[model samples]
Target: MESAIKWTSNETVLGFGKDAIAFLDTKLFSKKSPCDKKMYEILIIEPFYGGSHKVLIDMLYKALEDEYSDSKICMVTMTAKKWHWRARTSALYLSQVIPKQHAFRVMFSSSVLNLGDLIALRNDLADVKKIVYFHENQLVYPVREKKDRDFQYGYNEIVTSMVADTVVFNSEFNRETFLKSIKAFFKVQPDFRPKGLEGEIRQKTRVLYFPVMYDVGSHSKDYESTLHIVWPHRWEHDKAPEDFMKVLRKLSEAHCDFTVSMVGEQFTDVSKAFKEAETSLFPHIRHWGFLPSRREYLDLLSRAHVAVSTAKHEFFGVAMMEAAFNKCLPLCPKRLVYPEIYPNECLYNDSEDLFTRLAAFSRNVSAIKEVVADVKLDFSKYSAVNLLPHYVSLFK
Candidate 1:
């Protein structure tokens, strides 16, 4: 059957009020009334639903269900693959997939989707309290070369923020960097750039840390044993695996008594650094590759002495925090989000600085182990117990 919905612009769609409802009744629902449709209190749309995106949604779903047992929530999601394609077309695809239900009070989504286009396509969602969460922004995301940065992806994010009733970021750094880069990001445009958009979007912006539940059991730290280091991050170029491998090679050259667990998620084309590390640092590797079980992964972190991150692009470091929660000391770069999340003692300015810190710790394993046992990293703010309420409140 031919549909009857039509709109001139996003403004026209969102400007819809009582008249739009009457129009829907007359046009699209000529045969059936709005009351005949299934009702839902909440609607969630996630196009790139994988990795941290999946983890966050799963946590939020469980939290919402636990809090409001009677609330009917509907979610539409796609697997996290071909991210660029998902970003470009997910909104249109999801618009058709989502069924027409009774008016939704709240709509939650990540920044991956083109929210403006989604709202334009689905008139029912126009007046809903739309919330877009930014796990990462493309504006400052490091590319091999500045020229390689795709303008459309970043522009889509800016437009998404404009349409959302509430715009949220996983960290303050994530929020600030995106807002700061808006002007610079638009400089590439030849003409007809927007004005006052940054300020307009800022009013609805919020910084909420990604909620993590660290249910770790206490483990005895052995001071006499060799120091175990874990590098738990994606084996991707953005994570800077090459830099990490170089540091491990340095430790081996110095004859440092340490073992490494190079474990994290890996794609089909694994980083070449891992293959190189296998031959050079074979004696030092205790565990390598992705551990399918969460229990096994957490167990490895619990036993390890240190967790290190050498990331060129990180909005928030979940792996580092997880390791820290499991009693492992986190060693991260001073720049990016490390300063915002970890203490100065845990951050290193350069590879030499990281090597120096690791060399000292490796030489005196007993001393470092004692420090880890005594001093606990306070991650209370990011805990699911504390932040879940904030997330739940957003729906209302």
Candidate 2:
């Protein structure tokens, strides 16, 4: 069976909306498995196969398949939509869909799926060497209010990590934050509190940077005088598009010579700032909305002088790394994974600091250009060439 399942953005499965649920023919994995057949060496199971999650799986499958041509590998993935639903019910659905009798040496999945529940439901996979990768832990996931936070999501992560033989995180910050917040996250529960969960989870945890492949594009020299700023992130509340727009608004009010390209994956729940920006920052808008083609997105990044990230919640910053690799100066917040990935020169302490730096850069584009050219932001550690071998070791 083909590893990837194609589905249009507007297409709906059953009565569920386009983003709610996806259906796949079970016959693909349901065929009888004989005892004499060679056991599958590896299994890649991704419940929320979208965004960075999908990218990682696709990268792993391609690299592993190429490396182990003689061995048999199986992959089962669902579309990346309705993330909450995927987290809640994907284990049950995938448990039924996955082959029962097939023996596998290693199994890999993201934190989105409840590995414990899946193994409990499908005993065939209980003996497999389970590896759970955490892209973002629910413990540190930002919400407006403590009451608004769902206890089950964070609890699921704890349970998933507990059951897995190895728990991999994209960054040290992610691993530490998730581990530290385990006890506090469960404080919402009145009684019967869990203890020593963090220590147990810590034993199995390791940090692995998300592998990124960069295609160096021909930098556009047409708009050298005007500083081109790109904000490439999801159109969601967590990304803090509102704060980004506010900074852009201040720059606009100051009459800074800058063109803005606001591009990233858009979903049903879009931040109101995007709509407001269309009217407020209309004249300065250069390229807006998600670009379907990777080449075009890279080209846009190549053209831009500055790639700004106002993300309130980010675990591993793939987009910012890509932007930096494309020769764009990355201006990110001091907190989160930014400090780990980017140099102090590229980080801002507060919104006022962000505005101050951008405004100064806008007045003199050469300074920003020189800084991008001079600053040696080494992305070698995060490149696929350096990291693929590490990932390949996990399967063995």
Candidate 3:
């Protein structure tokens, strides 16, 4: 927990392992265990894509480093395709983003890695701690919903997470769903559910909400438009784009003076839902697709009156937080993790309720801000300051 490794590398040394020359505190360094001996080097199992996990990983790293600077972190990722983050010591096994044919060969194998600094257990690690984390996994995952690969990847996540010492979830919803799925899996293959495995899992399992990190960069833009609604989620089905399209069409028929911005990544194989929205509501859309500059996107959210999320499932809505941090009211459904993240009273269960709320917001936009203020979470509780201790306790 204390600063074990003296951080020596600057930004230039971080891109690749070229000069990953952080000083190792030999006096404190343990021979094998990467604990607080000399330097506490930790290995993080990165997500399939760059999104909320990236922010979580960054926050965890910073919070851990505030005291443990001598520590090292190695990220283990399946693909570097869309991942641009740099960790010199990371080990990439396979590109989960590539076609299934080519991916099978490169998918991560625990055999090839060096257990280095600390092997933060991940998918398919064959341990209870890691599997619990895998089971608790959530975050509007598009790849999981869009693809059908017999879940070789998910299987890997289950195995990897099971082996770790600490199994953590970003939200309680994610943790519970994972365990339920596992129990169901065991029902089919009863023998695989080891004798005392349930109790062990409960003991090791933890629900540690990830801290959000990333600047709400300076962006001052007063829109001429009266109603600025933002959908900052990815251009995918999880966001329920088809339903959002229907909302737009209904709102249009109502002749509401509103402008919508569709920000976030758009994959090559864009789904039917997004296509329908693009084709039908192209005129109403002001900005479409991902913007690399955080300022530009934050500016868009800041200026917007409402941040709408029509997600079918969200482990934790990072985009929702981005909007809320800047006073943009989140209008989301009372499903999965949304109610947990936002307010239970503010959630809408179906299209009728969502539309009803939207129509009301278009008339009294100030009500959106008022609603957000009323249910706004204590920022400190979700910050690195408070969250890190809870997270560290899991490791203990």
TM-score leader: 2
Best by lDDT: 2
Range of the 10 consecutive residues with the lowest summed lDDT in candidate 1: 6-15
Candidate 2 lDDT tens digits, 1-396 = 223332111222232122111221111122233222545667788888777887787667656766774246777788787888889988988877676657688999999998879989998888899999999988888898999998888888999999999999999989999999988888889999989998998998889999876565556644346888999999887889889989999999998888999888975565566788878998999998888666577778888989999988998889999888878889999999888878888999999999999999888887876787777677889987688789989988
In candidate 3, residue 353 scores what lDDT? 84
lDDT string for model 3 (132-236, tens) is 233224222345433432343334345444444555677788777765555444443436554444455557667766665423535533434467788888765
* Weakest lDDT window of 10 consecutive positions for candidate 2: 19-28
Cα deviation at 190, candidate 2, in Å, is 1.0
lDDT score, candidate 2? 0.80
Flag regions of model 3 displaced more than 4 Å. 1-9, 12-40, 47-49, 76-154, 188-197, 214-225, 271-276, 392-396
Off by over 4 Å in 2: 1-39, 221-223, 269-272
Candidate 1 local lDDT, 1-396, one digit each (tens): 122121111111111222322222221111232221457677776787667887777567656666654236666678777788889988888788676755578889999999989989998779989999999999998887778999999999999999999999999999999999999899989899888888999999999999876655246556578989999987877889889989988999999989999888874476566788787888998998888666667778878888999998888888888888777888889988879887776888999999998999898877766666665467788886688889999987
Q: What local lDDT score does residue 171 receive in model 2, on the 0 to 100 scale? A: 95
- Please give the ranking of all candidate structures by lDDT, highest first, separated by commas: 2, 1, 3
Ranking by TM-score: 2, 1, 3
The alpha-carbon root-mean-square deviation between model 3 and the true structure, to one decimal in Å, is 9.9
User: What are the lDDT scores of the predictions, listed in order?
Assistant: 0.78, 0.80, 0.53
In candidate 3, position 238 carries an lDDT of 60
- Provide the RMSD of all predictions against the true structure, rounded to 1 decimal: 10.4, 7.2, 9.9
